[model samples]
Target: MKIGLYFGTFNPVHVGHLIIANHFAEYSDLDKIWMVITPHNPFKKKKTLLDNHHRYQLVLEAVEEYPAIEASTIEFNLPQPNYTSNTLAHLKEKYPQHEFCLIMGEDNLRTLHKWKNYEVILKHHDIYVYPRIADSEDQTQHELLNNERIHIIEAPVVEISSTAIRKAIKAGKNCRPLLPQSVWRYIDEMNFYK
Candidate 1:
């Protein structure tokens, strides 16, 4: 089976996330999409993120209805400050039979060169890139585009972000429409981001 690994902190899984993952499942050749929840991202500050377990739970609720998409907590057990290259290596060892691919947005594609062992990753697995509205002016053309493994998918450009959702919740705004019903209820009941 060809599985696409969609990595994210999922501060709280929202509708935008579901749309993108679903789009990959429906639009790409990927047989399954794993929403890999990272315990800690090297680039993100922890203070704004919910606990790893809570984020995992939110993902579980967010994706439970979709058969092709599943929530994954694999990174939760690995050593802290998760790196995509390391996670991919561990996944290959754990599930050798299945073919794994990376799913990312256009914005992430811009900075792929800076990632640890990015060259190795590009050489080994296919990368499925989706459209993302860039928040800043980054005009450099990624040389990685020359690689045969990078497939640019014509998916919808989702502008919603987890950061905006968290800020809205903290401000006492009802952002339920931006999230899955179950995820919204879970966040509301747990009083997260308040």
Candidate 2:
């Protein structure tokens, strides 16, 4: 089985996330797109992050309908400031039966050089990059993605972002549109990240 690892904090899962995961699963050669709920990303700030368990649960609620879009918390058991290479290596060892590919945005692709052991990541695994609207500034990166294993997929641009959703929730504004109905209800009921 071929699986695409779609890693993200998913501060609160939304329609945009589901759209991309479904798009990849339905359109790509990948049999399933596991929404890997990254516990921590070295590049991003930790201040705004919700508890890892909450974030993971939100992803599960958002992707519950699609068996191919299940949530994974493998990173939760890894070290802090989780590195992609480390997670990938661990996953490969654990699930040797399944082929693991990467699913990321073009923005991440441009910054891939900064990641720990990026060379290994590029050399060992196949990548499926979805173009982000912001990456339009550098169209060349889309054409000149360094790795031969990389594939640039034209996924629907869902402008929704977790940053915007967090800001809205922090301000006591409604976050209905930015998140799934179940997630929104769960957040409200639990008062998460408040």
- Going through the candidates in the order shown, the clash numbers are 0, 0
Give the RMSD in angstroms, all C-alphas superposed, for model 2: 1.8
On residues 159-185, what C-alpha lDDT tens digit does candidate 2 reach at each position?
Answer: 898888877888988879777788898
Candidate 1 residue spans exceeding 4 A from truth:
135-140
After superposition, the stretches of candidate 2 with alpha carbons farther than 4 Å from their true spots are: 135-146
lDDT of 1 by residue, 53-148 (tens): 899999999999899999999998888889999999999999999999999998899998889999899889999999877777454435677689
lDDT of 2 at 112: 77
Model 2 steric clash pairs: none
lDDT values, one for every candidate: 0.91, 0.87
Q: TM-scores, in order shown? A: 0.96, 0.93
